[model samples]
Target: MAQQETDERVSDEFIDDTKDSAEREQAHRERGTVRPITVVGHPMLHRECRDVTAFDEALASLIDDMFASQRAAEGVGLAANQIGVDLKVFVYDCPDDDGVRHVGAVCNPVLDELPPDGRVLDDNNEGCLSVPGAYAELPRPDYAVVRGQDATGRPVTVRGTGYFARCLQHETDHLYGHLYLERLSKRERKKALTMMAENTPRYETVPNAE
Candidate 1:
Protein backbone atom coordinates (compact mmCIF):
# COMPACT_ATOMS: atom_id res chain seq x y z
CA MET A 1 0.00 0.00 0.00
CA ALA A 2 3.00 2.31 0.45
CA GLN A 3 6.17 2.51 -1.68
CA GLN A 4 9.14 0.47 -2.99
CA GLU A 5 10.77 2.55 -5.69
CA THR A 6 13.04 5.53 -6.06
CA ASP A 7 10.93 7.95 -8.15
CA GLU A 8 13.63 7.39 -10.73
CA ARG A 9 13.74 3.64 -10.42
CA VAL A 10 11.19 3.59 -13.24
CA SER A 11 11.86 -0.12 -13.49
CA ASP A 12 10.99 -3.35 -11.79
CA GLU A 13 13.04 -4.54 -8.78
CA PHE A 14 12.83 -1.21 -7.03
CA ILE A 15 12.93 -3.07 -3.74
CA ASP A 16 15.86 -5.17 -4.96
CA ASP A 17 17.51 -2.37 -6.84
CA THR A 18 19.94 -1.47 -4.13
CA LYS A 19 23.13 -3.48 -3.70
CA ASP A 20 23.53 -2.08 -0.21
CA SER A 21 22.21 0.57 2.17
CA ALA A 22 24.47 3.33 0.78
CA GLU A 23 23.08 2.81 -2.69
CA ARG A 24 19.58 2.93 -1.24
CA GLU A 25 20.27 6.32 0.30
CA GLN A 26 21.70 7.69 -2.91
CA ALA A 27 18.71 6.46 -4.84
CA HIS A 28 16.31 8.01 -2.34
CA ARG A 29 18.00 11.41 -2.32
CA GLU A 30 18.11 11.57 -6.10
CA ARG A 31 14.35 11.20 -6.12
CA GLY A 32 11.47 9.97 -3.99
CA THR A 33 11.87 6.47 -2.55
CA VAL A 34 8.95 4.17 -2.08
CA ARG A 35 9.37 0.95 -0.14
CA PRO A 36 6.82 -1.82 -0.40
CA ILE A 37 4.45 -1.75 2.53
CA THR A 38 4.61 -4.60 5.01
CA VAL A 39 1.06 -5.87 5.31
CA VAL A 40 -0.81 -6.92 8.47
CA GLY A 41 0.30 -10.18 10.12
CA HIS A 42 3.94 -9.45 9.36
CA PRO A 43 5.87 -10.17 12.56
CA MET A 44 7.37 -6.70 12.60
CA LEU A 45 3.87 -5.31 12.78
CA HIS A 46 3.40 -6.90 16.20
CA ARG A 47 6.83 -6.24 17.69
CA GLU A 48 8.22 -3.12 19.29
CA CYS A 49 10.68 -1.38 16.99
CA ARG A 50 14.36 -0.90 17.77
CA ASP A 51 15.53 2.57 18.72
CA VAL A 52 17.32 4.57 16.08
CA THR A 53 20.84 5.04 17.33
CA ALA A 54 22.52 6.29 14.19
CA PHE A 55 21.32 9.65 12.99
CA ASP A 56 22.91 9.19 9.60
CA GLU A 57 22.26 9.04 5.90
CA ALA A 58 20.58 5.64 6.19
CA LEU A 59 18.01 7.03 8.56
CA ALA A 60 17.34 10.05 6.39
CA SER A 61 17.01 7.88 3.31
CA LEU A 62 14.54 5.64 5.07
CA ILE A 63 12.46 8.65 6.03
CA ASP A 64 12.50 9.84 2.45
CA ASP A 65 11.33 6.44 1.30
CA MET A 66 8.55 6.53 3.86
CA PHE A 67 7.31 9.89 2.65
CA ALA A 68 7.42 8.69 -0.94
CA SER A 69 5.50 5.56 -0.02
CA GLN A 70 2.93 7.43 2.03
CA ARG A 71 2.31 9.77 -0.86
CA ALA A 72 2.06 6.88 -3.32
CA ALA A 73 -0.54 5.17 -1.19
CA GLU A 74 -2.26 8.48 -0.56
CA GLY A 75 -1.95 7.82 3.17
CA VAL A 76 -1.63 10.46 5.89
CA GLY A 77 1.21 8.82 7.84
CA LEU A 78 3.51 5.79 7.87
CA ALA A 79 5.74 4.06 10.41
CA ALA A 80 8.97 2.08 9.86
CA ASN A 81 7.43 -1.35 10.31
CA GLN A 82 4.72 -0.49 7.83
CA ILE A 83 7.45 -0.57 5.21
CA GLY A 84 9.39 -3.56 6.67
CA VAL A 85 11.92 -1.58 8.71
CA ASP A 86 11.97 -2.10 12.48
CA LEU A 87 13.35 1.26 13.51
CA LYS A 88 11.49 3.84 15.58
CA VAL A 89 10.59 6.32 12.87
CA PHE A 90 7.50 7.61 11.08
CA VAL A 91 6.52 10.30 8.55
CA TYR A 92 3.33 12.21 7.96
CA ASP A 93 1.73 14.99 5.98
CA CYS A 94 -1.68 15.02 7.56
CA PRO A 95 -4.11 17.89 7.85
CA ASP A 96 -6.01 19.10 10.89
CA ASP A 97 -9.80 19.44 11.00
CA ASP A 98 -9.27 22.92 9.62
CA GLY A 99 -7.31 21.53 6.64
CA VAL A 100 -3.98 23.01 7.74
CA ARG A 101 -1.16 20.65 6.70
CA HIS A 102 1.35 19.17 9.13
CA VAL A 103 4.31 17.26 7.66
CA GLY A 104 7.59 15.78 8.95
CA ALA A 105 9.25 12.77 10.54
CA VAL A 106 10.07 11.78 14.12
CA CYS A 107 12.31 9.11 15.62
CA ASN A 108 12.05 7.54 19.09
CA PRO A 109 8.93 9.57 19.78
CA VAL A 110 7.05 10.02 23.04
CA LEU A 111 3.48 11.22 22.87
CA ASP A 112 2.58 14.33 24.82
CA GLU A 113 0.60 14.23 28.06
CA LEU A 114 -3.11 14.06 27.40
CA PRO A 115 -5.70 16.41 28.82
CA PRO A 116 -6.58 15.69 32.46
CA ASP A 117 -10.09 14.87 31.29
CA GLY A 118 -8.84 11.88 29.21
CA ARG A 119 -9.47 11.49 25.50
CA VAL A 120 -11.23 9.48 22.79
CA LEU A 121 -11.07 8.95 19.03
CA ASP A 122 -13.05 11.08 16.63
CA ASP A 123 -16.36 9.67 15.36
CA ASN A 124 -14.92 9.21 11.87
CA ASN A 125 -13.15 5.89 12.57
CA GLU A 126 -9.46 4.93 12.19
CA GLY A 127 -7.39 2.73 9.86
CA CYS A 128 -3.84 1.39 9.26
CA LEU A 129 -1.55 1.01 6.27
CA SER A 130 -0.56 -2.52 7.30
CA VAL A 131 -4.16 -3.59 7.85
CA PRO A 132 -5.41 -2.39 4.55
CA GLY A 133 -9.11 -2.36 3.64
CA ALA A 134 -10.15 -2.30 7.29
CA TYR A 135 -11.03 0.49 9.68
CA ALA A 136 -12.96 0.66 12.92
CA GLU A 137 -14.08 3.22 15.47
CA LEU A 138 -10.91 3.17 17.56
CA PRO A 139 -10.69 5.56 20.51
CA ARG A 140 -7.47 7.49 20.97
CA PRO A 141 -6.62 10.87 22.47
CA ASP A 142 -8.18 13.65 20.39
CA TYR A 143 -4.98 15.68 20.57
CA ALA A 144 -1.24 14.92 20.56
CA VAL A 145 2.19 16.51 20.82
CA VAL A 146 5.00 14.06 20.01
CA ARG A 147 8.64 14.81 20.78
CA GLY A 148 11.69 13.05 19.43
CA GLN A 149 14.83 13.43 17.34
CA ASP A 150 14.88 13.96 13.65
CA ALA A 151 16.86 11.61 11.40
CA THR A 152 19.84 13.88 11.92
CA GLY A 153 19.62 13.60 15.69
CA ARG A 154 18.14 17.07 16.02
CA PRO A 155 15.39 17.60 18.58
CA VAL A 156 11.91 17.79 17.05
CA THR A 157 8.34 18.16 18.21
CA VAL A 158 5.05 17.59 16.39
CA ARG A 159 1.68 18.88 17.63
CA GLY A 160 -1.74 18.01 16.37
CA THR A 161 -5.37 18.70 17.14
CA GLY A 162 -8.31 16.89 15.56
CA TYR A 163 -7.62 14.41 12.73
CA PHE A 164 -3.91 15.19 12.77
CA ALA A 165 -3.98 14.10 16.41
CA ARG A 166 -5.28 10.72 15.36
CA CYS A 167 -2.49 10.44 12.80
CA LEU A 168 0.10 11.11 15.48
CA GLN A 169 -1.37 8.48 17.77
CA HIS A 170 -1.73 5.97 14.98
CA GLU A 171 1.87 6.29 13.80
CA THR A 172 3.28 6.18 17.33
CA ASP A 173 1.25 3.07 18.03
CA HIS A 174 2.94 1.40 15.08
CA LEU A 175 6.34 1.92 16.68
CA TYR A 176 4.99 -0.05 19.60
CA GLY A 177 3.40 -3.44 19.02
CA HIS A 178 -0.08 -2.02 18.51
CA LEU A 179 -2.17 -1.68 15.38
CA TYR A 180 -5.55 0.02 15.16
CA LEU A 181 -7.22 -3.40 15.39
CA GLU A 182 -5.83 -3.89 18.88
CA ARG A 183 -7.50 -0.65 19.91
CA LEU A 184 -10.94 -2.07 19.16
CA SER A 185 -13.17 -4.05 21.51
CA LYS A 186 -13.46 -7.81 21.17
CA ARG A 187 -16.69 -7.63 19.18
CA GLU A 188 -15.41 -4.87 16.92
CA ARG A 189 -12.15 -6.72 16.40
CA LYS A 190 -14.00 -9.80 15.23
CA LYS A 191 -16.08 -7.74 12.83
CA ALA A 192 -13.02 -6.06 11.37
CA LEU A 193 -11.20 -9.37 10.88
CA THR A 194 -14.14 -10.77 8.97
CA MET A 195 -14.25 -7.74 6.73
CA MET A 196 -10.55 -8.09 5.87
CA ALA A 197 -11.03 -11.77 5.03
CA GLU A 198 -13.62 -10.85 2.42
CA ASN A 199 -11.08 -8.61 0.72
CA THR A 200 -7.69 -9.26 -0.88
CA PRO A 201 -5.14 -10.62 1.54
CA ARG A 202 -3.16 -7.60 2.84
CA TYR A 203 -0.08 -9.50 1.69
CA GLU A 204 -0.70 -11.81 -1.24
CA THR A 205 0.85 -14.33 1.10
CA VAL A 206 1.83 -14.12 4.76
CA PRO A 207 5.40 -12.98 5.54
CA ASN A 208 7.82 -14.97 7.66
CA ALA A 209 9.96 -12.93 10.03
CA GLU A 210 12.39 -15.55 11.19
Candidate 2:
Protein backbone atom coordinates (compact mmCIF):
# COMPACT_ATOMS: atom_id res chain seq x y z
CA MET A 1 0.00 0.00 0.00
CA ALA A 2 1.15 3.59 -0.71
CA GLN A 3 1.33 6.09 2.08
CA GLN A 4 -0.60 9.30 1.62
CA GLU A 5 0.91 12.53 2.81
CA THR A 6 -1.62 14.79 4.46
CA ASP A 7 -1.09 17.44 7.05
CA GLU A 8 -4.21 16.55 8.95
CA ARG A 9 -4.13 13.03 10.27
CA VAL A 10 -7.48 11.63 11.34
CA SER A 11 -7.77 11.71 15.09
CA ASP A 12 -9.54 8.69 16.53
CA GLU A 13 -9.53 8.48 20.28
CA PHE A 14 -10.23 4.77 20.28
CA ILE A 15 -7.16 3.86 18.25
CA ASP A 16 -4.52 1.93 20.16
CA ASP A 17 -1.40 -0.12 19.36
CA THR A 18 -0.40 -3.34 21.12
CA LYS A 19 3.07 -4.50 22.11
CA ASP A 20 2.60 -8.08 20.92
CA SER A 21 1.66 -6.93 17.43
CA ALA A 22 4.75 -4.73 17.24
CA GLU A 23 7.04 -7.47 18.49
CA ARG A 24 5.63 -10.02 16.07
CA GLU A 25 6.18 -7.66 13.14
CA GLN A 26 9.78 -7.04 14.15
CA ALA A 27 10.52 -10.73 14.59
CA HIS A 28 9.19 -11.56 11.14
CA ARG A 29 11.35 -8.92 9.50
CA GLU A 30 14.43 -10.07 11.33
CA ARG A 31 14.00 -13.65 10.13
CA GLY A 32 12.84 -12.81 6.59
CA THR A 33 14.79 -12.61 3.36
CA VAL A 34 13.79 -9.85 0.96
CA ARG A 35 12.29 -10.93 -2.36
CA PRO A 36 11.67 -9.01 -5.56
CA ILE A 37 8.15 -7.66 -6.09
CA THR A 38 6.15 -8.85 -9.14
CA VAL A 39 4.99 -6.24 -11.60
CA VAL A 40 1.55 -5.59 -13.14
CA GLY A 41 1.75 -7.90 -16.17
CA HIS A 42 2.70 -11.02 -14.25
CA PRO A 43 0.15 -13.83 -14.62
CA MET A 44 0.46 -14.74 -10.96
CA LEU A 45 -0.93 -11.31 -10.04
CA HIS A 46 -4.05 -11.97 -12.12
CA ARG A 47 -5.12 -15.29 -10.66
CA GLU A 48 -6.95 -15.95 -7.45
CA CYS A 49 -4.69 -17.46 -4.83
CA ARG A 50 -5.20 -20.87 -3.25
CA ASP A 51 -6.56 -20.99 0.29
CA VAL A 52 -3.96 -21.69 2.94
CA THR A 53 -4.84 -25.02 4.56
CA ALA A 54 -1.54 -25.52 6.32
CA PHE A 55 -0.18 -23.44 9.16
CA ASP A 56 3.33 -24.83 9.33
CA GLU A 57 6.87 -23.48 9.15
CA ALA A 58 6.56 -22.77 5.43
CA LEU A 59 3.60 -20.50 5.97
CA ALA A 60 5.47 -18.77 8.75
CA SER A 61 8.49 -18.27 6.49
CA LEU A 62 6.29 -16.88 3.74
CA ILE A 63 4.83 -14.31 6.12
CA ASP A 64 8.29 -13.30 7.14
CA ASP A 65 9.36 -12.91 3.52
CA MET A 66 6.25 -10.84 2.81
CA PHE A 67 7.12 -8.41 5.56
CA ALA A 68 10.65 -8.20 4.26
CA SER A 69 9.45 -7.58 0.72
CA GLN A 70 6.93 -4.98 1.83
CA ARG A 71 9.55 -3.07 3.72
CA ALA A 72 11.99 -3.28 0.84
CA ALA A 73 9.41 -1.82 -1.47
CA GLU A 74 8.53 0.79 1.12
CA GLY A 75 4.91 -0.33 1.11
CA VAL A 76 2.45 -0.59 3.95
CA GLY A 77 0.89 -3.90 2.87
CA LEU A 78 1.60 -6.71 0.45
CA ALA A 79 -0.19 -9.82 -0.82
CA ALA A 80 1.37 -13.21 -1.44
CA ASN A 81 1.11 -12.95 -5.21
CA GLN A 82 3.13 -9.76 -5.12
CA ILE A 83 6.15 -11.92 -4.39
CA GLY A 84 5.16 -14.90 -6.63
CA VAL A 85 3.32 -16.87 -3.95
CA ASP A 86 -0.12 -18.10 -4.94
CA LEU A 87 -1.77 -18.28 -1.54
CA LYS A 88 -4.42 -16.36 0.32
CA VAL A 89 -2.06 -14.51 2.62
CA PHE A 90 -1.08 -10.89 3.17
CA VAL A 91 1.01 -8.91 5.63
CA TYR A 92 0.58 -5.33 6.75
CA ASP A 93 2.36 -2.73 8.83
CA CYS A 94 0.07 0.17 8.13
CA PRO A 95 -0.95 3.17 10.14
CA ASP A 96 -4.55 4.22 10.57
CA ASP A 97 -5.82 7.72 9.91
CA ASP A 98 -4.90 8.63 13.46
CA GLY A 99 -1.30 7.54 12.73
CA VAL A 100 -1.57 4.49 14.98
CA ARG A 101 0.44 1.64 13.55
CA HIS A 102 -1.01 -1.88 13.20
CA VAL A 103 0.95 -4.91 12.14
CA GLY A 104 0.00 -8.54 11.47
CA ALA A 105 -0.32 -11.30 8.89
CA VAL A 106 -3.71 -12.66 7.80
CA CYS A 107 -4.30 -16.00 6.12
CA ASN A 108 -7.33 -16.99 4.05
CA PRO A 109 -8.83 -13.61 4.86
CA VAL A 110 -12.56 -13.03 4.60
CA LEU A 111 -13.68 -9.43 4.52
CA ASP A 112 -16.81 -8.73 6.53
CA GLU A 113 -19.77 -6.79 5.23
CA LEU A 114 -20.03 -3.25 6.47
CA PRO A 115 -23.05 -2.08 8.40
CA PRO A 116 -25.16 0.89 7.31
CA ASP A 117 -23.43 3.25 9.68
CA GLY A 118 -19.96 2.14 8.59
CA ARG A 119 -20.50 2.68 4.89
CA VAL A 120 -18.74 5.99 4.82
CA LEU A 121 -16.42 6.20 1.84
CA ASP A 122 -13.01 7.79 1.65
CA ASP A 123 -11.90 8.49 -1.92
CA ASN A 124 -8.20 8.66 -1.32
CA ASN A 125 -5.23 8.11 -3.61
CA GLU A 126 -4.49 4.40 -3.62
CA GLY A 127 -1.37 2.67 -4.97
CA CYS A 128 -0.06 -0.87 -5.06
CA LEU A 129 3.40 -2.36 -4.73
CA SER A 130 2.76 -4.36 -7.90
CA VAL A 131 1.73 -1.26 -9.81
CA PRO A 132 4.92 0.47 -8.64
CA GLY A 133 5.13 4.22 -9.35
CA ALA A 134 1.52 4.93 -10.27
CA TYR A 135 -1.38 6.03 -8.12
CA ALA A 136 -5.03 6.77 -8.69
CA GLU A 137 -7.84 8.01 -6.51
CA LEU A 138 -10.13 5.21 -5.43
CA PRO A 139 -13.08 5.30 -3.09
CA ARG A 140 -13.23 2.64 -0.39
CA PRO A 141 -15.02 2.25 2.88
CA ASP A 142 -13.31 4.22 5.61
CA TYR A 143 -13.77 1.30 7.96
CA ALA A 144 -13.10 -2.39 7.39
CA VAL A 145 -12.94 -5.66 9.28
CA VAL A 146 -11.21 -8.88 8.16
CA ARG A 147 -11.46 -12.32 9.75
CA GLY A 148 -8.70 -14.86 9.30
CA GLN A 149 -6.11 -16.89 11.10
CA ASP A 150 -2.61 -16.06 12.20
CA ALA A 151 0.52 -17.90 11.10
CA THR A 152 -0.03 -20.40 13.93
CA GLY A 153 -3.62 -21.12 12.81
CA ARG A 154 -5.15 -19.19 15.65
CA PRO A 155 -8.30 -17.29 14.64
CA VAL A 156 -7.83 -13.55 14.49
CA THR A 157 -9.94 -10.54 13.56
CA VAL A 158 -8.48 -7.29 12.25
CA ARG A 159 -10.34 -4.02 12.06
CA GLY A 160 -9.24 -0.62 10.87
CA THR A 161 -10.51 2.79 9.90
CA GLY A 162 -9.11 5.29 7.36
CA TYR A 163 -5.72 4.51 5.88
CA PHE A 164 -5.35 1.12 7.50
CA ALA A 165 -8.82 0.12 6.33
CA ARG A 166 -7.78 0.95 2.77
CA CYS A 167 -4.70 -1.25 3.14
CA LEU A 168 -6.83 -4.19 4.30
CA GLN A 169 -9.18 -3.83 1.35
CA HIS A 170 -6.38 -3.31 -1.16
CA GLU A 171 -4.32 -6.31 -0.06
CA THR A 172 -7.41 -8.52 0.13
CA ASP A 173 -8.27 -7.55 -3.42
CA HIS A 174 -4.85 -8.70 -4.60
CA LEU A 175 -5.45 -12.15 -3.10
CA TYR A 176 -8.66 -12.36 -5.13
CA GLY A 177 -6.93 -11.63 -8.46
CA HIS A 178 -7.99 -8.01 -8.49
CA LEU A 179 -5.89 -4.89 -8.78
CA TYR A 180 -6.64 -1.27 -7.97
CA LEU A 181 -6.18 -0.58 -11.67
CA GLU A 182 -9.28 -2.64 -12.48
CA ARG A 183 -11.43 -0.26 -10.46
CA LEU A 184 -10.41 2.72 -12.55
CA SER A 185 -11.89 3.99 -15.76
CA LYS A 186 -10.17 3.01 -19.00
CA ARG A 187 -8.52 6.41 -19.39
CA GLU A 188 -7.36 6.46 -15.80
CA ARG A 189 -5.94 2.98 -16.03
CA LYS A 190 -3.99 3.95 -19.10
CA LYS A 191 -2.80 7.04 -17.37
CA ALA A 192 -1.48 5.05 -14.46
CA LEU A 193 0.30 2.62 -16.76
CA THR A 194 1.87 5.47 -18.65
CA MET A 195 3.11 6.92 -15.43
CA MET A 196 4.58 3.55 -14.51
CA ALA A 197 6.48 3.38 -17.77
CA GLU A 198 7.96 6.81 -17.27
CA ASN A 199 9.18 6.37 -13.70
CA THR A 200 11.75 3.70 -12.89
CA PRO A 201 10.93 1.89 -9.68
CA ARG A 202 13.50 2.33 -6.95
CA TYR A 203 13.32 -1.31 -5.87
CA GLU A 204 14.05 -4.44 -7.88
CA THR A 205 11.04 -6.08 -9.57
CA VAL A 206 10.43 -9.47 -11.12
CA PRO A 207 9.57 -8.86 -14.75
CA ASN A 208 7.06 -11.00 -16.58
CA ALA A 209 8.56 -13.69 -18.79
CA GLU A 210 8.44 -13.13 -22.55
Candidate 3:
Protein backbone atom coordinates (compact mmCIF):
# COMPACT_ATOMS: atom_id res chain seq x y z
CA MET A 1 0.00 0.00 0.00
CA ALA A 2 1.14 3.55 -0.77
CA GLN A 3 1.40 5.79 2.25
CA GLN A 4 0.80 9.56 2.09
CA GLU A 5 2.04 12.28 4.39
CA THR A 6 2.40 16.06 4.51
CA ASP A 7 5.39 17.97 5.88
CA GLU A 8 4.08 21.20 7.32
CA ARG A 9 7.59 22.60 7.60
CA VAL A 10 7.87 22.66 3.83
CA SER A 11 7.30 26.38 3.31
CA ASP A 12 6.58 28.39 0.18
CA GLU A 13 10.12 29.61 0.29
CA PHE A 14 11.27 26.09 -0.57
CA ILE A 15 9.35 26.18 -3.84
CA ASP A 16 10.58 29.63 -4.86
CA ASP A 17 14.15 28.99 -3.93
CA THR A 18 14.24 25.70 -5.80
CA LYS A 19 12.75 26.74 -9.15
CA ASP A 20 15.38 27.20 -11.85
CA SER A 21 15.69 30.18 -14.19
CA ALA A 22 14.13 28.39 -17.13
CA GLU A 23 11.21 27.14 -15.08
CA ARG A 24 10.71 30.65 -13.74
CA GLU A 25 10.67 32.09 -17.26
CA GLN A 26 8.24 29.44 -18.44
CA ALA A 27 5.98 30.24 -15.50
CA HIS A 28 5.99 33.95 -16.26
CA ARG A 29 5.22 33.31 -19.90
CA GLU A 30 2.39 30.98 -19.04
CA ARG A 31 0.75 33.53 -16.72
CA GLY A 32 1.01 36.09 -19.60
CA THR A 33 -0.96 39.29 -19.02
CA VAL A 34 -3.08 37.92 -16.19
CA ARG A 35 -1.98 38.48 -12.64
CA PRO A 36 -0.80 35.33 -10.89
CA ILE A 37 -2.88 35.94 -7.77
CA THR A 38 -6.38 37.36 -7.37
CA VAL A 39 -7.70 38.74 -4.11
CA VAL A 40 -11.07 38.16 -2.43
CA GLY A 41 -14.26 39.71 -3.87
CA HIS A 42 -13.14 39.11 -7.44
CA PRO A 43 -16.18 38.08 -9.45
CA MET A 44 -14.24 35.34 -11.20
CA LEU A 45 -13.60 33.66 -7.89
CA HIS A 46 -17.33 33.27 -7.29
CA ARG A 47 -18.21 32.16 -10.80
CA GLU A 48 -18.46 28.48 -11.64
CA CYS A 49 -15.40 27.55 -13.66
CA ARG A 50 -15.98 26.38 -17.21
CA ASP A 51 -14.90 22.99 -18.47
CA VAL A 52 -11.78 22.59 -20.56
CA THR A 53 -12.83 21.84 -24.11
CA ALA A 54 -9.93 21.78 -26.54
CA PHE A 55 -7.05 20.20 -24.65
CA ASP A 56 -4.80 21.99 -27.08
CA GLU A 57 -1.95 24.39 -26.59
CA ALA A 58 -4.15 26.80 -24.67
CA LEU A 59 -5.22 24.15 -22.21
CA ALA A 60 -1.69 22.96 -21.75
CA SER A 61 -0.49 26.52 -21.27
CA LEU A 62 -3.14 27.16 -18.68
CA ILE A 63 -1.99 24.12 -16.76
CA ASP A 64 1.52 25.47 -16.71
CA ASP A 65 0.27 28.84 -15.59
CA MET A 66 -1.73 27.27 -12.78
CA PHE A 67 1.34 25.42 -11.57
CA ALA A 68 3.39 28.59 -11.76
CA SER A 69 0.85 30.52 -9.75
CA GLN A 70 0.70 27.75 -7.19
CA ARG A 71 4.45 27.72 -6.67
CA ALA A 72 4.77 31.50 -6.78
CA ALA A 73 2.13 31.89 -4.12
CA GLU A 74 3.49 28.98 -2.08
CA GLY A 75 0.12 27.25 -1.93
CA VAL A 76 -0.34 23.50 -1.74
CA GLY A 77 -3.10 23.86 -4.30
CA LEU A 78 -4.55 26.53 -6.61
CA ALA A 79 -7.62 26.84 -8.82
CA ALA A 80 -8.10 28.62 -12.14
CA ASN A 81 -10.59 31.13 -10.73
CA GLN A 82 -8.08 32.16 -8.08
CA ILE A 83 -5.90 33.47 -10.90
CA GLY A 84 -8.83 35.20 -12.67
CA VAL A 85 -9.35 32.39 -15.19
CA ASP A 86 -12.74 30.65 -15.12
CA LEU A 87 -11.56 27.23 -16.23
CA LYS A 88 -12.05 24.05 -14.24
CA VAL A 89 -8.41 23.45 -13.51
CA PHE A 90 -6.04 23.38 -10.55
CA VAL A 91 -2.46 22.50 -9.61
CA TYR A 92 -1.04 20.88 -6.51
CA ASP A 93 2.37 20.02 -5.09
CA CYS A 94 2.33 17.87 -2.03
CA PRO A 95 4.77 15.64 -0.22
CA ASP A 96 4.68 11.88 -0.35
CA ASP A 97 5.45 9.43 2.44
CA ASP A 98 9.14 10.00 1.80
CA GLY A 99 8.60 13.77 1.81
CA VAL A 100 9.41 14.02 -1.89
CA ARG A 101 7.48 16.56 -3.95
CA HIS A 102 4.69 15.23 -6.12
CA VAL A 103 3.44 18.04 -8.35
CA GLY A 104 0.71 17.84 -10.95
CA ALA A 105 -2.25 19.60 -12.51
CA VAL A 106 -5.80 18.55 -13.26
CA CYS A 107 -8.22 19.89 -15.90
CA ASN A 108 -11.98 19.57 -15.97
CA PRO A 109 -11.60 17.42 -12.90
CA VAL A 110 -14.07 15.38 -10.91
CA LEU A 111 -13.87 13.89 -7.44
CA ASP A 112 -15.77 10.78 -6.42
CA GLU A 113 -16.51 9.62 -2.93
CA LEU A 114 -13.78 7.54 -1.37
CA PRO A 115 -14.07 3.78 -1.56
CA PRO A 116 -16.40 2.39 1.10
CA ASP A 117 -13.41 0.68 2.70
CA GLY A 118 -11.25 3.79 3.02
CA ARG A 119 -10.33 5.93 5.97
CA VAL A 120 -12.55 8.35 7.88
CA LEU A 121 -12.82 12.13 7.73
CA ASP A 122 -9.98 14.26 9.02
CA ASP A 123 -10.11 17.97 9.75
CA ASN A 124 -7.14 20.16 8.95
CA ASN A 125 -6.10 23.77 8.62
CA GLU A 126 -6.51 25.08 5.10
CA GLY A 127 -5.94 28.41 3.37
CA CYS A 128 -6.50 29.77 -0.10
CA LEU A 129 -4.62 32.08 -2.39
CA SER A 130 -7.85 33.92 -3.13
CA VAL A 131 -8.41 34.56 0.57
CA PRO A 132 -4.87 35.36 1.59
CA GLY A 133 -3.71 35.26 5.20
CA ALA A 134 -6.80 33.45 6.44
CA TYR A 135 -6.59 29.84 7.57
CA ALA A 136 -9.43 27.69 8.79
CA GLU A 137 -9.80 24.25 10.23
CA LEU A 138 -12.13 22.54 7.79
CA PRO A 139 -13.35 18.97 7.83
CA ARG A 140 -12.60 16.94 4.71
CA PRO A 141 -13.14 13.37 3.69
CA ASP A 142 -10.05 11.34 4.40
CA TYR A 143 -9.87 10.00 0.90
CA ALA A 144 -10.97 10.94 -2.64
CA VAL A 145 -10.92 9.38 -6.08
CA VAL A 146 -10.09 11.97 -8.73
CA ARG A 147 -10.34 11.69 -12.49
CA GLY A 148 -8.87 14.29 -14.78
CA GLN A 149 -6.49 14.98 -17.63
CA ASP A 150 -2.87 15.97 -17.55
CA ALA A 151 -1.13 18.72 -19.46
CA THR A 152 -0.96 16.57 -22.58
CA GLY A 153 -4.64 15.65 -22.29
CA ARG A 154 -4.01 12.11 -21.22
CA PRO A 155 -6.56 10.59 -18.86
CA VAL A 156 -5.52 10.11 -15.27
CA THR A 157 -7.09 8.67 -12.15
CA VAL A 158 -5.72 9.29 -8.67
CA ARG A 159 -6.75 7.88 -5.32
CA GLY A 160 -5.62 10.30 -2.68
CA THR A 161 -5.79 10.10 1.10
CA GLY A 162 -4.78 12.28 4.03
CA TYR A 163 -3.50 15.75 3.21
CA PHE A 164 -3.37 15.15 -0.51
CA ALA A 165 -7.06 14.33 -0.48
CA ARG A 166 -7.70 17.44 1.56
CA CYS A 167 -5.90 19.63 -0.96
CA LEU A 168 -7.72 18.09 -3.93
CA GLN A 169 -11.08 18.55 -2.24
CA HIS A 170 -10.27 22.15 -1.49
CA GLU A 171 -9.32 22.93 -5.09
CA THR A 172 -12.36 21.08 -6.43
CA ASP A 173 -14.61 23.27 -4.29
CA HIS A 174 -13.21 26.38 -5.95
CA LEU A 175 -14.13 25.00 -9.35
CA TYR A 176 -17.75 24.78 -8.20
CA GLY A 177 -17.97 28.36 -6.91
CA HIS A 178 -17.41 27.27 -3.33
CA LEU A 179 -14.92 28.56 -0.82
CA TYR A 180 -13.64 27.02 2.38
CA LEU A 181 -15.38 29.70 4.34
CA GLU A 182 -18.68 28.36 3.04
CA ARG A 183 -18.06 25.04 4.79
CA LEU A 184 -17.52 26.62 8.19
CA SER A 185 -20.14 26.45 10.89
CA LYS A 186 -22.24 29.60 11.42
CA ARG A 187 -20.40 30.48 14.60
CA GLU A 188 -17.07 29.76 12.96
CA ARG A 189 -17.95 31.95 10.02
CA LYS A 190 -18.93 34.78 12.30
CA LYS A 191 -15.73 34.51 14.27
CA ALA A 192 -13.61 34.37 11.16
CA LEU A 193 -15.38 37.36 9.64
CA THR A 194 -14.94 39.28 12.85
CA MET A 195 -11.25 38.56 12.88
CA MET A 196 -10.93 39.70 9.28
CA ALA A 197 -12.93 42.83 9.98
CA GLU A 198 -10.74 43.69 12.91
CA ASN A 199 -7.39 42.95 11.27
CA THR A 200 -8.32 44.46 7.92
CA PRO A 201 -8.98 48.14 8.47
CA ARG A 202 -11.52 49.89 6.27
CA TYR A 203 -10.36 53.30 5.21
CA GLU A 204 -13.52 55.32 5.82
CA THR A 205 -11.55 58.47 5.10
CA VAL A 206 -11.54 57.50 1.46
CA PRO A 207 -14.14 59.16 -0.76
CA ASN A 208 -15.64 55.83 -1.85
CA ALA A 209 -17.39 55.35 1.48
CA GLU A 210 -18.90 58.83 1.63
lDDT of 3 by residue, 97-192 (tens): 345454667676677655656658687777666665567788888777666665565565555667777887888888888888889998876776
Instruction: Write one digit per residue (lDDT tens) for candidate 2, span 92-184.
Output: 999898877898888877777788785999999999888889999999999998777678766667888999999999999999999999999
Q: TM-score ranking from best to worst?
A: 2, 1, 3
Query: Model 3 misses residue 98 by how many Å?
Result: 5.3
Ranking the candidates on lDDT from highest down gives 2, 1, 3
Candidate 1 TM-score, true structure as reference? 0.79
Question: Which sections of candidate 1 miss by over 4 Å?
Answer: 1-30, 118-121, 201-210
Per-model RMSD to reference? 10.9, 7.9, 9.4
Candidate 3 lDDT trough over 10 residues, lowest sum: 201-210
Report the CA-based lDDT of candidate 3 relative to the real structure: 0.64
**Model 1 scores what on Cα lDDT?**
0.72
- Model 1, position 81, has a per-residue lDDT of 88
List of clashing residue pairs for candidate 1: 3-34, 3-35, 3-36, 4-34, 4-35, 5-34, 121-140
Full-model lDDT for every candidate = 0.72, 0.85, 0.64
TM-score per prediction, in order, is 0.79, 0.89, 0.73
